[model samples]
Every structure is written in C-alpha cells, then in structure tokens.
Target: MSNVFDGYERQYCELSANLTKKCTAATALNGEQKKQKVSEVKAGLDEAEALIRKMDLEARSLQPNIRAVLLAKLREYKSDLNNLKNEVKKIVSGNINPSARDELLESGMADALTASADQKTRLMTSTDRLNKTSDRVKDSRRTMLETEELGVSILHDLHSQRQSLLHAHNTLHGVDDNIGKSKKILTNISRRMNRNKWIISSIVLALVVAIALILYFKLSK
Candidate 1:
C-alpha cells in the first residue's frame, strides 16, 4: 500500500516538473508554439488529476488517520491542478497573451509597447504561480514521508505485541502439564495406602481368635 502511494507520488512530481518547464519555455515562443506547449501542459495536468483521483480512492480503504491526511493532500493537488488548467486555458485563448512585438509593431508604436508590457506582467505572474506550486509539491512530499514513517512504526509495535502474547500462552501450557502429572502421582500413592490398611486388619483378627482357643483348652484340663 505504501509502495502504491510512492509510485503515484513519483510520477506526479516528474510530470509536474516537466509541465512547469514547458510552461516557462512557452513564454518565449510565437503564438503557434505557445499554443502547442499549452496543449501539452494541459494534457500533463489531466494525467496528474487522474493520479490524484486514484490516490483518493486508495486512501479511502485505509485507516482513518491515514485516510484524512491523504485526502487532504489530494484536495490540495486537485485545487492546484485546476488553477493550472485555468491558467493554461487563458494562455491558449489570448487572455494571458505572450508578447508578439514584431507583429504588433506594424500597427502603431504605442500599442506595441503597451501590449509588450502587459505580456511581461502576465508572464511574471505565471512564473510566480509556478514557483508557488513547486513549493507546495515540496511540502506535500515531506508530509508523505512523515506519514509513511509513522505507519511503519505502528506496524512494528503490533508485531512485537503479538510475539509477547504467543510466548505467554506457551508458558501457561507448560504449567498445566506439570500440574496434571502431580495429580496422577498423588492418586497412585492413595491407592497403595488403602491396600496396606486392609492387610493389617486381617492379621489382628487372626491373633485374637488364637488366644480365645488357648483359654478354652486350659479350662478343660
């Protein structure tokens, strides 16, 4: 289960990094190239979104504490992906236009200058957003590592407790065997004592009969 999450996280980070680099490079390209890059970034975001949904489903089958952390992280990633998708769409639709200085220069000098400035500001904003997303990815990675470590510790403790209980159970079984042997020995001794008492009573009865016969003979003489 931990391995599953590890795989998902690795794939997510790799794809996200690739997409961010593409977005940065797109800023310097012409309209057609920028559109192509935006399309590619959108595809990557879609893949990442699928991975998050998979993680969310897996988390639901886990323990409550673990589920909560995983779900929270999933939500954060989903929100970031949504924002990224919107930003990429804006770029594609000319809302967050990149500089086309040479083409705009034919129109008028003032219009070209203003458009260039707006494009630069929008690019800067996009860069800032990318940096923030990178920071969040780092934080999420750290949290996942902590959660994995905690789960390992819990499993180790449970295994130790099971071993202790098994040892105690074996010890009690040995004690019960010793007690059964002692009871058998005591029963044999009791039977021997009863046999000795019966033999002594028979000998005393014979001696008393012999003494009575001797007295009767002496009186007859």
Candidate 2:
C-alpha cells in the first residue's frame, strides 16, 4: 500500500538523521552534552529497530521487488547501527580523539623546545664564564712570570754592587798598610841623626882639655 511505503520512507529518513546526530555526538560532544546525546541516540536506535520489525512483517504482503528493496535497506541500516555501536564502545574505552591528541602533542613539543633552548643558553653562559676565568688565570701567570724576572734582575744588580764594595774595601786596606810602613821608616831616620850629633860633640870637648894641660906643664918647667 502507498501508506505503508510512505511510512517506511519516513522511518528511514528519521533513522538516517539519528545516525548523523550519533556520529556527531560521539566525535564532537563532551561532558553532559555527550551524555544527553548518547541517551537520545540509544532511544533512536531502539525505535528504529522496532520500526524495522514492523516493516519486516508488512514487507511479506508487498510485491517481490518492493520486499527486496526494503530488506536491503533494513540490512544496511542494521549494519550501520552495529558499526556505530562498536564506535561508541571504542570511544567509551578511552580512545583519544585525533584532534585533541595532536594539540597536546604540539604543546608538549613546544615546551620541550623551550626547555632545550634554555639549557643551551645556560651552557653557553657557563662556557663564557669559564673562558673569562681562564683568561684571568693566564694574565695572573704572566704577571707572576714578569715579577720573577724582575726579582732575578734585582738580585743580579745587588750581587754586582756587593762585588764592587768588596773591591773598594780591599783597595782601602792596602793604602792604609802602605801609609803605616812609610811612617815607621821616617821615625828610624830621625833617631840616627840625633846619635851622630852626640858623638861629634864629645870628641870636640876631649881635644880642647888635652891642649890646655900640655901648655900648663911647659910653663911650670
């Protein structure tokens, strides 16, 4: 009958709309919205099943071609419902949505990249500080070396001055010894001249006394 066919078409259109809503709910809806959508989908599926059963009973009274088309549509709808049920099961089992998973991955990768860049910056700063410390050490070593060289030069100058002072001291000691010997020689010459003068005066006095005694004896005779 025309009314029976029209009822079947309307039921098919309703079931298709319910399937679209269920798919959208499974993929897009969340929280209370998702729960409400799932309840609606389950009720729709039950109604569709009931409608199919009624159509199947009436289908036997139709033409063979009409019955075949209805049977095919029923089988297709049943298959789709079974597949959607499996999809819901997977969703309930905690399978992550692809879009959400991609977003989380991108955020994690950005954090990792930022952490790596900070580590690199810290390493470079440490390296620069180490280089500065090394340069300071090198400058200190060079300054120490220069100081050592200066110490050696001062020691050499001190040694030369000490040698010159020793030579001058030896020369002064030699001059003092020569002057002491010259003074002793002058004292010996003055004592010899005084002894010679005393001998000459004694000889002159003895000669004058002998001549006076000889003249007195002649006068007495």
Candidate 3:
C-alpha cells in the first residue's frame, strides 16, 4: 500500500538529509571522523529497521482486510446463487409467476456467479502483487543497511546517499504506478458488470412476457 511506502519514503528522506548533514560534520571530526560516520550510519540503519517493522505490520493488516472483502463478496455471491437456483426450479416446475420470474432468470442475478469468480481471480492477483512488492522492499532495505555498514568512504558516502535518494524516489513512483493499474482493473470490471446486468434484465423481461402470454391463452381455453 502507498501508506507503507510513504512511511519508508519519509524515513529515506530523513536519512538522506542526515547523511548530508553528517558529511559536513565529518569534515571537522579531526581524529573521530570515522567513529562519527559509523555512529551516524548506525542511527540511520536503526531508523530503517523501525520503518521495516512498521511496514511489516501494515502488510500483515492488509491480508485480513483482503480476506474479509473476499469473504463478504463470496457470501453475497452464494446468496445470489441460491436465489438463482430457486428461480430455475420454479421455471422448470411451472411454479413461477408470469411476471417477475423472467427477471430473476435473466437479469441482475443471472451472471452473479461468474462475476464472483472473476472477483476471486482479481483478489488473488492483487495478493500476489502485494507480496512481491513487500519482498522487494524488504530486500532493498536490508541491502541498504548492509551497504551502510561497510566502511563508508567520505566521497563515496555522499555519492551513495544521493544515489539512494534517487533510487527510493524511483521505487516509490513504481509503487504508485502499480496501485494505479490495480485500480484501473477494478474499475473496468465494475463497468463490465453494469453492462451485463442491463443485458440480463432485458432478457429476463422478455422471457417473463412470453410465459405470461402462454399462461393467459391456456387459462382462456
């Protein structure tokens, strides 16, 4: 989620800023420059570890929310499916009223099962993406911390911080793009479901009319 990434980005910015400040501070460290650099690096790594923990918690929270959404959708679909089955039984047994039975058979509830299946598929895809992104972020953060520990060169430290900032910026942009794609997919599915519902309604209405005419003729005889 953007929340988790934003948290990391905020820390990354703070770390980068601190690194810049320390570079200036390093110049006047006299005999303690190396010690001071190590201390700053350790502090930054600790901040990174804290950020990771926060993001991990956020990621774990997402799983339950996602599962709850999927479960709710499944429950709705199951209820709709049961209603659809009842409608089919009535149609077959000649128990359906001539008016509303056709709508039940053809409209809003007809393809509900299919939509539910699609939703499950989308949920799985989203889960996979979330996992992959989380892994990448964790790995990158670990690498950054490790790099920080490996005896920073004064010139190399500044350069690395600049690069790290740029990397973090680009990574956050990628996360934004991914979230956008997920949103787009969900929107398209919603539109498709609306169209399907309209079509199903018309078909059901026609079926209901035909049943009504047949019943009226039989009754007149």
Could you say which candidate leads in lDDT? 1
- Candidate 2 residues lying further than 4 Å off, grouped into runs, are 1-112, 200-221
RMSD values for the candidates in order, in angstroms, are: 11.9, 34.4, 48.3
lDDT of 1 by residue, 1-221 (tens): 24465457556655655665565555556678878887788788889888887777788888888888778767766775675576565556664432552332332344334435544664565566567877888999999999999989999999999999889889989888998998899888888888878887878888788888998899889
TM-score of 1: 0.43
lDDT of 1: 0.68
Q: What TM-score does candidate 3 reach? A: 0.29
What's the distance in Å from true for residue 70, model 3?
91
Q: Tens digits of per-residue lDDT for model 2 on 1-221?
A: 33464466456555645554464545565677777777776777677677767777777678998788767766765775576566555555557778864554464355345545544664465556567877988999999999999999999999999999999999999999989998888888878878877888778777778878988899889
Checking candidate 1 for backbone clashes, the offending pairs are none
Rank order by TM-score, top first?
A: 1, 2, 3
What range of 10 consecutive residues in model 3 has the weakest lDDT sum?
Answer: 19-28
Q: Which model is ahead, 1 or 2, in terms of lDDT?
A: 1
Model 2, residue 51: displacement in angstroms?
Answer: 75
* Model 2, position 67: C-alpha lDDT score: 84
TM-score quality measure for candidate 2: 0.41
Q: Number of clashing pairs, model 2?
A: 0
Which residue segments of model 1 deviate by more than 4 Å? 97-221
lDDT of 3 by residue, 1-221 (tens): 44454445345444434433443343334445646664665565456446555644554466676646544534443353344334334433444454554454344332444444554665565567678888999999999887877646656888989999999999999999999999999999999999999999999999999999999999999
